[model samples]
Target: MGRWGPDARGRLEAAALELYTERGYEQTTVAEIAGRAGLTERTFFRHFADKREVLFGGSTRLQDLVVGAVERAPDTPAPLEAVVRGLEEAGAFFQQNVGRLRRRQAVIDANAELQARELSKFAALASALRGALLRRGVADPAAGLTAEAGIVVFKTAFERWLGETGQRDWSSLLRESLDDLKAVVAGDEAQADPP
Candidate 1:
C-alpha cells in the first residue's frame, strides 16, 4: 500500500459518480470506483462507507453550513428571511458543482433507494433547521413551518438550477425560488369563495 494523497477522496467521488452514471448505481462496485480513480479499495472505504454514500455523503456538511447560517442570522431578519439566509449559505455547497449535482440527481432519480435517501436527507435538514430556529427563540409550529418552507424553496430552486443550460448562480436561483414561494402564498388569499 502507498501513502494516501490529498486528492484520494475527491478522486474517489469523481470516479464513483462516473461509474454510477455509466454502469448504473446498482451495478457499480467499490472496487470499480477505486480502480477508476486509480486508488485502492481501502482508500475508498476511508472516504465513504459504501457506493451510495458517494452520492449522499455531503449531506452532513451541507446541513452544518445551513444550520450555522441560521444560528448566526441577525435578529432583524424575519423567520423566513433567516431560513433563506441559511439556505443561501448551504447553496454554496453546489456553487460550481452544478454539473456534478445534475449527474447525481439523475443517478438518484433512477434508483428508488437513492431517491428515498435524498428525501431523508431533506427531512433531516428540515429538522435541523427547525432546531436552529428554536434555538433562536422561534416558537413551535412557526419554527417547524418556516424550516419546512425553506426546504421546499431550496428543493425547488435546486431543481430549476438542474434544468438550466446557461450558467447561473445557485444562490440567485434560490432567491428567485423564494420570491416565487412568496408570490404563491400571497396569491392564495384571493382564493376565497364569493360571499
Candidate 2:
C-alpha cells in the first residue's frame, strides 16, 4: 500500500495490531507503525491521537450504533428488552469483526492499561445506553439498571463467544446469556445445574 492509500486508517490499525502483537504494545512506536502501514507519522496522527487510540478508535462508532438501536427500538418492549435490542445490534457488529475483535482482546488482555481502558469503554457504553433509554421515556433507576444489566449480558456473552470455536452465532450467544441472567434473577432451580 502507498502512503496515500485509500484506507489509511485501516492500514494504520492493522499495522498497529501487528506490531503490538509482535512486539509488546509498550515497545511499539508511532513511527514504526506508520512505516509498517506505508504511512507517515503525520498520517497516523491524522487518523489517531496516539498509539492507544488505534485500539479504541472504533469505540465511538460502536457507541453510536448501540445508542441508535436503542432509540429506534419499539416502545412496547420493557427497558431491558429495549436494551437487548441495542445489544443484539452490537452483536451483529461483533459477528462481522470477530477475527479483529479476538486479536484486539488478546492484545488488551496482555496489558493492564489496555484492560483498564476496556473497562472504561464498557462504562461509557453503559452510560450511553442509559441516556438512550431515558430519552425513550424509561424512568431513571430502571434505565440505569437495565443499561448496566445489558452491559453485563454483553460482556458475558462476548467472553463466551471469544472462547468458543465459532459453532454458534453472536445473537444466539447473546440471547442465551440474557436467558441465563433472567433465570438467575427469577431464582430458577434449573440454573443450579452445570450446563
Candidate 3:
C-alpha cells in the first residue's frame, strides 16, 4: 500500500485494458478491473473517473503536449510543420505504450460508444491544435485546415503503426504520413495545372 500507491494507476490501466480486451468493453466493469489489478474499487476511482476514463485518461496529457509543442515551435515554421511537431510530441505517448495502444484501439473499434468517444477526442484535439496555430500567428481557415489535416496524418500514422509489429517508430510513421499528404496535394496541383 505504501510504495505500490505510486504504481497503482498504471496497474489499473493495464488490468483494465486486459479485461476490456478479454471481456469486451461494455461487459467489463470497474469492480472486475480493480479485482484484476489487485486493487480496490476506491483505488480505481482514485485513478480514473470511471471505466471509460481508463482508455481516454491520457488524452489530457496528450493535448497538453501538443499545445505546448505548438507554442514552442518556431514562428517561421510552416503551419503544417508546426502541427506536425505538436502531433509528434503527442504521439510519444503511443510509442511508449504500443501494446496498450493496440489493445485500446481494438476495444474502441469493437464498440460504438468507444468509437464515438475516440472521434470526440480527435475532434477536440483538432480544435485545440487550431487554436494553438492561431495563437502562433496563423490565419483562420488555414489554421483550421492545417489542424484538421494534422488529425488525419496523426490518425493514419497511428493506425499504421498499430497494425504492424515492425521496428518502425511512431515519429517515422507520422513523418511518412505527412510526406504522403504533401505528395498527394502536390499531385493534385500538378493535375490541375494546364499542361
Candidate 4:
C-alpha cells in the first residue's frame, strides 16, 4: 500500500490512457496502471473507484462547476442561453486540460464499453441541466427542450473543440452550435407553417 501522491490521480489517468492505447482497455488492468505509475493497486483504487471511472474522472466535478455557473448567472438570459453560457464559462477548465481530455476521449472512442459509459455520463449531465433549468422557473417541455438543446450544443461544441488545438476556445464553438441549432429549428418551423 502506497500513498496516493498529489499527482497520483492524474498520473493514474494518464497511465491508464497510455495502457489503453498500447494494449486496449480490456487488456489493461488496474495493477498494470498502478505499476506503470509507480503506485500500488490500493493507491489506484483510492484515486479512481474503478477502471471505467478513469475515463470518466472529474466529469461529476465538471458538471457541478458548470451548473454552479448557470445558477450564478443573472436571471435575464433565457433558459437555453443560461445553460449555454454556463457551459461556455467552463471553457477555462477545458482549455486548461484539453490535451489530457482529448487523449482520454480517444481511449474511450476506441472502446465500446467506455463509449457507453460516456453516453451515460452525457445523459446524466443533461438531466442535471434540465433540473437546473426547472429550478429557474422554466416549465414543462421548455425546460426539457432547453436542457436537451444545451446538451446537443455542448456535444457539437465539444467535437469542434477537440478537432482543433487551443487555437479555438470552447465558448466560440458553443456559440456557433447554438446559432446552428437556432437556424435549423427556425427553418423547420418555417417549413411547418405552410409557407
lDDT of each: 0.88, 0.90, 0.87, 0.86
On lDDT, who's better, 1 or 4? 1
lDDT of 4 by residue, 157-181 (tens): 9989999966877888999999999
Per-residue accuracy of model 1 over 16-121 as CA lDDT, tens digit each: 9998889899999999999999988987898898899888777888998889999999998989899988888756568668788889899999999999999999
lDDT string for model 3 (107-147, tens) is 98998988888899999999999999889889999999999
Q: Tens digit of lDDT per residue, candidate 2, span 1-195?
A: 676778999999999999998998999999999999988999999889899989997788889988999999989999988888787787767877888888888999999999999899999999999999999999899999999999999999889999888898878888999999998889883635666
> Which is the leading candidate under lDDT?
2
Q: Would you estimate the TM-scores of all the predictions?
A: 0.89, 0.92, 0.88, 0.90
Please rank every candidate by TM-score, starting with the best: 2, 4, 1, 3
Model 2, stretches more than 4 Å misplaced?
1-5, 189-195
The clash count for each model shown is: 0, 0, 0, 0
Per-residue lDDT, model 2, residue 38, is: 85
lDDT of 4: 0.86
TM-score of 4: 0.90
Q: Is candidate 2 or candidate 3 better by lDDT?
A: 2
List clashing residue pairs in candidate 2: none
Q: After superposition, how far is residue 88 of candidate 1 from its true place, in Å?
A: 1.3
